[model samples]
Target: MAVMTMEQSTSRSILPAAFRTAGVDALAMIVAMVLAALAIYLFGNAAMQRVVTYAAIMLTAVLGLQIFSGNTGIVSFGHAAFVGLGAYATGILTMPAALQRTALRDLPQFLAGHEMSFFTALVVVLVLAMLVGLVTGIPLFRLSGSSASIATLALLIIVYTLLVAGREITRGSQPFYGVPREIGLWTAVGVAAMAIILARLFRETSFGLATRAAADDERGAAAVGVDHRVARLAAWVLGAVAAAAAGAMMAQFLGAFSPKDFYFDFGFTMLAMLIVGGMTSSLGAFAGVVVTVLVVEVVRRFEGGGVIFGLQMPVLFGLTQGVLAVAMILVIWRRPAGLFGDRELNLLRRPNAKMDPVKPATDVAPTRAAAGPISVDHLSRRYAGVVAVDDVTLSFEPDSITGIIGPNGAGKTTLLNMIAGDVMPSSGIVRIGAPVRQASAFRFARAGIARTFQNIRVFPRMTVLENVVVAARVVEPGLAAAEAAARRELARMGLERFADRPAASLAYGQRRRLEVARALALKPRFLLLDEPAAGMNAVETAELVSILAAVRSERRIGVILIEHDMRLVMNLCERIVVVDRGRVIADGAPAEVQNNPAVVAAYLGSRTARARQGNDVQ
Candidate 1:
């Protein structure tokens, strides 16, 4: 037997082997689902079992939707098309050749003559659905917000039309029967369990984290080097695969169906489940499915009422739908974040109040020699006819603290935006090492540039540690390495204790510090800060000054700050650039810029103008 070294033994015993591979939340969810399935299997009648089985299938589909819509905050109305495709593909492949010869005679010769097992048909359908998702996502992911949602709705319409119009392949909205009814309650329960695990695991991956970050704050995520389009596309493809699986099961369960079965009504029902339960987590998806299915079943039984309390009851048409709609509205009004609110159901105790401190990995540190001064030449930005930044040529050294300050509307923020690649220059060049020809924030971030917004843009839905991890992942190779880097930054910024707390729950001063920590986690060669101390109190401002001083001393990275806090500017910045009315008026050491005649005249004139305007006000 070989003896283990102390270091090896310590590492091995640090965390449970199972938790290293999976999260507590995922395991808890799986257990809950299994128990629920067992309850139905043991006690329910055949009819109740059937309803639960159908609910399991719906859960799979809803989980798929949650994977995309929940993470990207982009509601998709077209995912049902993938479900429909899966059902039709499975049916066509698994149906007997004899039946295909009669019912689907117009199917292609290959499809008409062949039949496959349920598992094989499902595999084929999943692959086909992924292909469709990729092709559609290329165009659809290019859009965001309401435009993207509308595009998805259009996708559903197009797919529905194709299913109805392709008379030879689909029989043109007619029922295509003879599908093998091989799927039972156990099969659906197994698939749903798998989907739940897959979704939960994906949510913990780097791609999923990036997608959720982008959903929370697009510009902020971009500033941390997240590729929003790529993240969204990955979620889109995965969600389609899940939806396809659900469709395969549904086809075998029902044995026969028409295009209309997966049309508007079907899509709306799936959407309702996601909305009512919560659109942000796998747990919410599960809860929503159970609640919706139970409500629907109960209401359905009373639709053709016989009697209640010895009184005759009239039949109520569409009562289930009406009640569902009202329930969704209530959930939206009372709990807009959904029932779970982006949280997982974890019954296990939190492993530890604080994460084990990990030393900073040397390989992930910033290479000082690789950084060069950022040069901006004749940079100008215009909006319509008004110039936001006009011919403001400047250079920022790689190891200096520079401040750009003036009265309100002095274009300080605009100038910083141009340099950080958040805004396009109308007619000028910004060079990190070479001229950057495009305005892309994520590209700049990946090239050793990181920034914080004037308004705090932390991903509010993410934990404090996760906010920094998002940026750290840009430079680190894997999630573990990224987390180590993040924790190091959090400790340095005095946020280690609040690592598990939501970013939105932090105090204003703490949020400001958190933003700085997030920016620092990128190991950027240049860091741009806009009004970092805007809402901070005097004590917080003093702490910020010390933190910035230490950062400059330790990292030797260039810092460009835009603020109206004169005391902070005078104390923290070695060099100052004064801008007024979109033009640079003075630049030198802080003392020199402070006393420059042009700087004094610009401030005095602006104050006078403001006073005159106030006097003229009604």
Candidate 2:
């Protein structure tokens, strides 16, 4: 009934989204900059810079884990190993020992004993980590949920073994000297900034959401065309590169190092730091590193000789680590997601709820074009030899409102998954218009198709605006594009008012609206909505119906609605498809499909009720 009130619809070529420029993000970044400046001003000398640089490197590593673990909802035990990869690679290329020895035998002898610059060494470390990531990532990326976590642990073991066994290359765990101590405050800060920016962009993208969704529910994400393998690989390779960067920074700071520096001790050290620092926000990584490092240093300085309960005690450092670790464990058990979780801080709320409406956009990527028609032909999907959908054929015609209704065990979801390319078919073609054999999840999305889940998958730690912006993740690959696109989508969904609120805080109806808005931002030729009206009050359902109708008519984009709300279905669907047990039972206009005895009996459980409704209406 309501036509977006005024002009909530966004401009086709919008600038950046309001969420990308959120007042909070600017304030937080500014705070970081200010704090960095303050630290430099107070110390401003080599002594202090050397000390802070190591702390910064550790924090950067923890931040990388936070991205791979905290926001994406997958725990990585091998991040430290990636750091080792960087350190060892750097040591081999730049250290005097490496220059003196013709190790790696296969590598050119000229390269050995040839002193490489810090910049070159840094580049080599990152590249080596990336290459290793590409190979190791394949197996980890193929796994789903908790299983993938176990695989990463295996990866850590493999990496550790390689480093320790390669005596010739790594000097048999001995100290590799002549590794330049060239790291400084400015270098650490620059790398940290880059790492944080990359992480922020990943978190704000669809790839980030898909990672979480897979962790939360793999099948659900795949149904929306989110390829788990590719998403995981992107996270792994990037996270590995980050780890290498952190390791290089650490090596530069220490100036002398060995393979043992990157073993379990280092891994545990980084893990504790990440856990205490809040593991979900980039800011948390910084906080955790500073706090943990200070705590450990202060305790070690005292040598366990502290007064507890007015009694002098020994082994204070031991007590300090134990207490710190326990505190972190408790925080996690009680508030599993950590202080900030995956959300960026907001600083411009002005202390009034009303002023919240004027908050800025906070997206890293956004789409620029509207979608066209989406077509799926002979699409099918299978799981472990069982065909969920077999050679199914359908199309969401451009600019039409279509509905698909089915029972619990029907193949409606399976078909949707194939179109989205979340699940590759045993054999079939799926394309918006062209004939194709198969496509990647990102590719499917890029080809102009977007969808929502049936169970309402929201990123719990993210704000409403963040959720939308992150969905626009795949649409815009960089910071500026994502920012513009997320803003335009937020306004369209009427969620501009609730932009900064955490997703878990929103009412059920609002969450549904945000999910739809995220899909719309993809600017798909067709939108597949799975149960948009599920579990809604009458008022809420009515609101949703209006919103959907307006979108279909105004956007000129076809929609495939998968819902159980009979009233909403009858009212909105121009044509309906009914299915049961992995196959379509009937297809026709709502009235005709409603009258079909088989459809009523199979899905609604009553033809008599349908007859009664028809009679009453007449």
Candidate 3:
């Protein structure tokens, strides 16, 4: 009976327990899918079978979209492009050879000669979709939020235009026909079930969780060594493949469809399903499909002027579309997260989570004590007329703590960002061992440099242990190994007791330590801490100083510490680098810098220094 603490329970009252358990959530999906199969088998006529089969097809496509859109928190409207490609691929291949000779005379030689089974066509569709995903993901992933969404919409338009203009192969917008209809109710049900299972499994994998962490906070994920580009691209390709499969299945099910079938109308409907159900989980996808299908069916009956039992109904034009629009709007207004809202129904017993007291590793590998010193050679960063870091030169040695202290806007953080590869330098180079060329944040992170932000940026949705495990995965390949390492780090930070608690439930000081713990999980050679002691009380600050001492003394890890606390910096650092107005003002030992006249004037002001010394005490 493992349960969250009082603090943890209080923070996520709206979240469901089942949503967090993969086994339970997956079982719920299996049950719903089985019930759908049972219903179709027991009482389905030709028309009823068509309705259920169409719903299953929609579910498959929606689940595919959920893999990327739900997990990455990026809304995409371009999945239909892949669907359209799949439809064309299947249509061209599965169409009769005689029809291909007569109608698709303008198609490529290879395509016109090939007419394959559904499985073979599906494989080809998947490969083509993956190729498109790889090409498009490179640039699209560089942008975020609304910009990324708009770019995907642009992709839809581009693909649609290409399909329309490519008249030779596709017969333009005139609708190419004569395809064999091989997809049946059982086939759709089986594929839909597979899609649901795949989506759920992917969402629970280490790679999937890593993408979600990035979606929550990109900078936080980067600082912890998550490769943002790679994770997003993997998801994009996977989603594209799934979408392609659904498209092939739909083409075979519908018997014939035009380019318009997979364009805006289909794309918007699929996206709306994901949004109205809850884009974060597969259960939401399933729930949305069921609700939309039911609503559409009822509205269609009214629009057709049908008789319900005995009485004849009045005809209602566009009623089906109007109802769907209103339902989507109402869902958005009332429950913006959708009806299920990332929750899944659970109906199974599960094993309890093991909370074994983790023993310290007997043979813990030591951090690189003699990793070559990080050298900053006249590094500069300028935006328009403003210079954030102006030709600052410094070198940090291995196995020592170097303190960077200065007033606000003195470029201390800017220097760290350049070294860590967050900001590209306008001029000069940052060499970290062997003169490495072209440094980026991911490159520096992989090269044994880890940093923490001034404002704490822990992934709020992840547990205390998960936050550390995500970073640990960079160095450790196995999930078991990573979780074990994360536990050790948490124990070292005295956070073992709160391992299962969400990061947001921790106190301010605990959150700060968690950030440090996450950084340590990277096995960094040089740690860059930006104002780590910012929001700490006296006791907490002293604890942080002690923890830093242990990190240097025990692990032999070098630290570049930035702090406004003069006492802590002066006492802890062996060498101090002081900067003022984007340039180094003084660089020396604590004793020398404390007494230097320029240092005193820049930090304390001449009058304030004199007043403190009783020389200007009116």
Q: What TM-score does each of the candidates earn?
A: 0.94, 0.77, 0.87
lDDT tens digits by residue: candidate 3, 249-336: 9889877778898898889889888888988888999999999998889878678787877988878787776787888899999999
Candidate 3: 10-residue stretch with minimal lDDT = 1-10
Kindly state the number of residue pairs that clash in model 3: 0
For model 1, the superposed segments whose C-alpha errors exceed 4 Å read: 1-22, 347-364
- 1 against 3, candidate with superior lDDT: 1
**Model 1 per-residue lDDT tens digits across residues 1-618:** 123244334543464322344476776766777787789889988887889889989999999999999899999998898889999999989988898888877888776766999998888998999999999999998899899999989999999899999888888888878999999888998898889888887886778889999999999999999999999999999999999999999999999898998888888889899998899988889889989998999889788878977888899998887888988899999999777767766444352377566543333347642578999999999999999889988999988999999989989999998888888899899999999979999999998888999999999988887799889888876666676678889987888888877899999889999999999998999989999999999998998899888877777889999988999999999999999989999999998997899999999999999999999994
Please estimate how well model 3 matches the true structure, expressed as its whole-model Cα lDDT. 0.82
Clashing pairs in 3: none
Cα miss at 261, model 1 (Å)?
A: 0.9
Native-to-model Cα distance after best TM-score fit, residue 441 in candidate 2, in Å: 5.5
lDDT of 3 at 612: 78
